[model samples]
Target: MGVADQINWVDAACWNGTAFDGGWNTRLATNQDVLEPATGQALWRVGVASAADMTAAIERAHAAQVAWAATPPRERAAVMLKAAALFEQHFDELALMIARETGGIIPKGHHEVRESVVLCQLAAAMPMQSQGQVLPSTPGRLSIARRVPHGVVGVISPFNFPLILSLRSVAPALALGNAVVLKPDVRTPASGGFILARVFQEAGLPAGVLQVLPGNAEAGEALVTDPRVPMIAFTGSPGVGRRIGELAGRHLKKVSLELGGANNLIILEDADLDAAASAAAFGAWFHQGQVCMASNRVLVHASVVEGLKARLVGKATHLPVGDGASGQVALGPMIDAKQLARFDALVQETVQQGATLEAGGTFEGLCYKPTVLSGVKPGMRSFDDEPFGPLVNLVTFDTDEEAVSLANNSQGGLSSAVISRDVGRAMAIGEQLNAGMVHINDQTVNDDCTNPFGGPGLGGNGSSVGGPADIDEYTRWKWITVKASVPQFPF
Candidate 1:
């Protein structure tokens, strides 16, 4: 049965003063389903919470966080470890739910679930590494730098890769002793927020340390603007990220915004064409290219442009496209109809601008066939904006200088990749790119659970939210000094 024909709509889950209570329910779209994009199919059935309820939840979280933070880091680590184990135990179940809710292919869903487990494990080990430093100071005096939690953190998560991204933000916040009142994307709340809440509860988290409030932007806005919420960690579009920054700015709250990207992938003449082609295919198509770090633009050397395009097209064509639940499916439907429309509009715009459609430009229902376009220029929407779908734009450059120029043309500096047989040269180019993270001879989506992952500039606000360094994002540095003798007071 089609998604439109399946399920009843109801409040999937909500905060009830102390804990998340309710079950998942399907509801009709609040707007005309036809006018709404495929990605927006999941309607907002959960009753919207009043600002007072949100304020109360934040207050409760603050109260719980005082005691929760007082609990030793080791104890918090234990709970995180248990949650990781629980994540592993429920991997298949979580993967299935993720696939259904977000339209992630089965394999990709499984990969994200496994990665989520690893992220929790990494978060669990964070306390051991979150040590303070002693600074050299004047004789008979000591200076110490310590990390402190920000009391209550409001996490506003996006819909794409819902479970993984939400956990990526939440696990670190909880591990660092901050209470979290998460506002998950309205579309895929059950798969991530609801599931993780169960995991945390089972892992013995304090009653109010982790709360899930699933609703629309109003819900998230309420959380971020609330004075009790000291920090806001958000992952979504640059437009939304800007709004979040503005709100957080007005309140003088700490903010971490992981926004959109029109990432570039450069293929040098000396690069192993096969390796570059494979990486490009995976980077472009993974999770239907919904990832913030996905390579949206491809800049290949003119010397090997034909070869790279041939191999990439062949690989993209063989990818299995079907329902996310079928298990054999490699590419699933766009997250919802809204996303499909956006993808369609972008591709149409590209065609109108005179780009060549190399393969897979048509859509069947909500399924956008993996597409590749050649002869793309920097000024086109596909090159300047994020498509957030399984579409790849290929442009050719004659030299490394030209490639760097082309790659840096986009306003986004989230991530980039340089493929070349000359590792040193690729590394040099990678460093020169303005992206937050760059890969040599590989794709930008390759991330380590224990390594810092975030973009620079518009891609991110120079904050690292993953890896061992992630604890720093959840913490604030406080310096303390002790003197051997108190100085005489002067009136």
Candidate 2:
């Protein structure tokens, strides 16, 4: 079946919860084709939102915020729960569309959809969670502080993991009584923005409560600087995230950023070589290494570096790679040629700096082979820069201390992992690493609805989302006090 048959709303203009602007559906000058990365086929043509479009969406969201926030908490939770149900009902369809839209394998498509469902369900529960607490004050006064929603939240999500990342902010914000204006990546507008808006709309969300605007940097800057949008949630590269942080600071707006990472995975000498190899392979090649949490640098113990490398290379060479829409494959195509070129340049520079290419280093269409590099150490391009492709760098460390030092040597510390047969020892090493999230016996790429998802330094602004952190990210405390009568005061 064609993609249009699978997703009926692919041709609609952007979902702004307002009257369609003249630019939409007019095939105007700003319209761009959404291409299937693997085949370079145009799946749909969408109207790119301009700065004016962004302002309109945010204004609508801001106008709707008061009524949505006043809607009973149970009513809000009900709508979110229904949205979660709709996501579950359309899981397979959404997964197929994700694969076609983003060049992700079937498994990754399903994973993204499932995580988005989990996020919806998690957000549904927030309405019932304790929003605030009563505090002691004078005998005649009752003082309390309660969490209240920011009027409107502007969400800027990336192309990778589009559905879940966008929903992570949208779900919680709406459930907490805040309206949302989401600006998904221009590349995957349907899966990231339109599909989400469709789901929530079907679930009985009121108009203007959630708006999806697909646009470029101008729209993003408008969303950030809009005085009405009190908070901005962004997930993307470090450069753009830093720029957003700076702009938000100048406007005195609250911002939460989830940026890029050059994460590390360490294999101790005592680690089960087979298991460690499998973990490393999955971490580096899963989703074609197009994830912030992908294991970019592998720090293995000197005694077992060769052993682990052999197993990892064996896995890399055998894993299937192809167009995701064709069938199940271990690695899918890169998002596009630009991203592929970026990753390829990093690999070439690293090789020129003396690292040995062990397994694969070529491409077929957008599918780059799962590549493994050895003799990689600090200061090498492959070791320092994040390759958001199917590539892994192998480095050797003599001791656990050295392993920790090497792992901590990067400015980006989003996630880290350590593999060892000794659980306590691995845990100790994981603790020493500078990453926000650490795994003792697993790989660097990991996620869950209940865990806090963020890191310190370049990974983020030391702020977090998911689980309990969502409350802090989406709401602010408002102190309220009441008394039966005014106390007599001597002035």
Candidate 3:
């Protein structure tokens, strides 16, 4: 069936050069149902490509990348520019599809699509940027360095913010003259995988340059281990990222990992309580706190903890929560039952261990209430581990040193924030915190295509994406040298 026959991309299961209903090899075909988290409805069924299918996709991508690399840089940029225009043209339809496929609220879907447009536009500029540098060499020689794409790139993207994360790597790789074989999380096949293939194909990207394979662990392992694919871009948990890193290392393939985060939002005593509370609430509950940059830990001054707690409770209690596609709800449902259970367990364990549940410790179906927990201290489950949910753990601190110490006491080092009236003090505190990206007056959940994204430690592998970072992440440096004549003495 055509994708437009029903919802935007209902039957878009897998695309290997062309959209197909079953796997490339029908004998090994397997299908998995894609379910909507808010309502337990099956949005579509995706063909779960096996390891052999993944290998075939990689081989095809490798073959296509050579000609793509030889193509003129302007032609590549033109393709990216067309993709960006197409994204804008179909903005509403794509937003609705994101909402239906991923349970994202309408506004969040719009935001994701908007970010995607920026990503595509940013990629369009990459092909024209200076890829190398000229260096001074010996008297009779010239030395130069240039950037070039690494044949075929393998991408493993996550479900949350599927469109942005997938396109973050996919668009740049293609613009840099590399073919890509993308494996989006099985739960978000349409928005993350096949939909991209359709958009790029419509944008005039050549056949076989981009392959979307939505499958399970077998396919992921095959993609990582394949000798033909030399680079892997992954975004998900630290566990999976570590595994991919290990396998990619064994095979000598370069890998870029944008992994998990247990982010912090620090509130100082001199800060405005109302503004701090608002930032905390938004950071903790935006997209139901499914983001890796969600403010799981909110560290406030001991003297003003009570005031901030009251404000946070009021905001959490009043925020609407339900199906995102139905109306203007502030929070949407958890992605699935497994994620719901994980969040619930952390809250339960924290409360049992003596953290007071200030408000919202209830859930109906997948819609978890925007929750707040006070008296939460170090060693608490919610404080130590990343509760990727709409639950905020409030910890009290006595001084700026304590606040910085607490914020740095985690396995994650992604995004963080500081809110205070004194701009200088906020900047000082933010600088001391060991995080990749820090905002002085904003919340933790902030992102843009112009800035470098990804952090140190478990947050990522010291690799970044966006703007100039793309040249480093998607391409490699090659040094070239020329001499006026062959040296006779060296031989």
Model 3 Cα shift for residue 342 (angstroms): 1.0
Best-first order by lDDT: 2, 3, 1
Backbone clash count for every predicted candidate, in the order shown: 14, 0, 0
Clashes of 2: 0
* Candidate 3 residue lDDT tens string, 199-237: 787788887888888878999999999999999999998
Q: Model 2 over residues 245-304: C-alpha lDDT tens digits?
A: 999999999999899667999998888999889999999998899998999899999999
Tell me each candidate's RMSD, in Å, in order.
4.1, 2.2, 2.5
Instruction: Give the distance in Å from residue 35's predicted Cα in candidate 2 to where it truly belongs.
Output: 0.3
- Where is model 2 more than 4 Å wrong at Cα? 8-29
lDDT of 1 by residue, 168-198 (tens): 9889888888999887776676665777887
RMSD of 1: 4.1
RMSD of model 2 against the true structure = 2.2
Q: Per-residue lDDT for 186 in model 3?
A: 84
Alpha-carbon lDDT of model 1: 0.78
Candidate 2 local distance difference test against the native: 0.86
Best by lDDT: 2
Off by over 4 Å in 3: 1-28
Question: Comparing candidate 1 with candidate 3, which one achieves the higher TM-score?
Answer: 3
